[model samples]
Target: MADNLLELDTPVIAILRAPTAARFAEVTAVLQESGITAVEFTLTSEGALDALRDCADFAYPIGVGTVRTAEDANRAVDAGAAYLITPVVSDEVIHEGYRLSIPVISGAFTPTEIHRAWVAGSTMIKVFPASLGGPDYLRALRAPLPDIPLVPTGGVTHDAAKAYLDAGATALGIGSPLIGDACTGGDLNALRDRALALREELK
Candidate 1:
């Protein structure tokens, strides 16, 4: 089920791609306070590894994103990532992640790629830029490849998460809409409130 893929009780996954370490921490605190149990720091973000280490003590599941190589996967593991998420499927990264006993979510856009990632030992197949296809895309993909666990990422909104779940996605990966831009001036209270609202909505 969906619960098996996350290894956590909650279905939400917060993507923290802030431009600075301070902003990353700020966003992470807000997400935790909001009751989200899963968080990911994209490698494209500055100080992402340090930020991951900073929040290692939180009760939620912490993970890293945009991982492309074995070295990146190892770095993320060393930084205390409970899981690894890649923007694209990489055998090297997936193999390294498995070696470290860290669950890997490999990004795949097509049924072929999804099946490939699943066969490669990926914990879940992330459908990147999922907005383009929306829930309908997942619904269509599920008909023939119902066995693959899919997590729709990129452009997923708080209001749209449940639809993806209903459409057969294992879970949802929320980014900018949830975390907002680091320079846009984030409001911890607002983020927390939104997160809480999202959790409630999911239920």
Candidate 2:
């Protein structure tokens, strides 16, 4: 499954971090038209798993984010998530994801954490708060560990998306920049536009 996911080489994972989950479907509908097929629902959001279940059958992949525990991983898997994402590297969650055959994107910053996450069986590494280091940071990480796939999250805008990818990021995790106010305000067209524009840049 991890290989299958990598093969998708999805340009971005549209992230929803709202306090409410009602708009999951709405945002998804708009993103779908723009060819944004990978989405992540943060556990910090209310009813995150419920939102996942609601859209489990969608044509795209749905991932659970902010997963910090084995229980969270289990719940996310039970909710039918295709993959799991963590804000911090959690070996328990990574092990759980491995057992479930679900890819876990463990978050890390320093080279030590990133390498540790990879050595601990993380399916991939997420460079959290990636904006602080930006593409240059990723370039540095890739210098010694070019084989480990990295996913950059936080402060990754459409304009900066390609730079990270070029720096060796296997994919991106775009949050509000992708979701924007469209989820709550029902202006999903904004998200559609962003998604479409991003796809154009990535392509």
Candidate 3:
């Protein structure tokens, strides 16, 4: 199993949230088959911690998202999470990640928040709800803060992925647009099709 995020070649982070994480393995297998390896399991899901411990042997980076507190961060790390992702800028979470030596993708919306997160030692700044500003906003942010790696999450569609990358997004945090009910007893085939389509779009 791979433990390092640096080994991830694809710049796409699949954000998975569901009623239960029992179907996580099945869904992750489909994504892996489609060439999207990086996956984030949000704590809001049922049995997510157990799933993280269960998927420790997976051969790709598996991260924990929606992390808000230091206790959750520690718990995730103890459960073998390769990285931690937050929905907002939390100094405690970022410091915990730094202490644990795990990467933290801190979420932020405005330029001030982004810079603050970067300076606070966030591994990457997740420009959340990126649909609001779109690629042009990313371009504007990159103009001054070119060195900060940005991952745009929330409402990133397959067709718009390339535009985000073109706008200087280091990676994308995609959810429903890619997962598409796969974890909720929806068609696995449909999920695969979407994943394949996303791969093609990225290429």
Task: State which candidate has the highest lDDT.
Answer: 3
Candidate 1, position 181, lDDT? 62
Model 1: which ten-residue window has the lowest total lDDT? 1-10
Give one digit per residue, the lDDT tens place, for model 3 in 58-174: 777589999999999999999888889999999999999999889999999999999999999998889999999999999999999999989999989988899999999988999
**Candidate 1 lDDT by residue in tens digits, 1-203:** 22445554457688887566557766777777767778888898888898778876776658899999999999988998888999998999999988998889999998889999999999999999899999999999999988887889999998788899999887889887777664247677777777888888887
lDDT for 61 (candidate 3): 58
Please give the ranking of all candidate structures by lDDT, highest first, separated by commas: 3, 2, 1
* TM-score of each prediction: 0.93, 0.96, 0.95
Alpha carbon deviation, residue 34, candidate 2 (Å): 1.3
Clashes of 2: 0
- What lDDT does the true structure give each of the candidates? 0.83, 0.86, 0.89
Q: For residues 53-136, write the lDDT of model 2, one tens digit per residue.
A: 888668776888999999999999999988999999898999999899899999999999999999999988989999999999
Please rank every candidate by TM-score, starting with the best.
Answer: 2, 3, 1
Kindly report which residue pairs in candidate 3 clash with one another.
Answer: none
**Ten residues in a row with the worst lDDT in model 2?**
1-10
lDDT of 2 at 173: 85
RMSD of each: 2.1, 1.2, 1.9
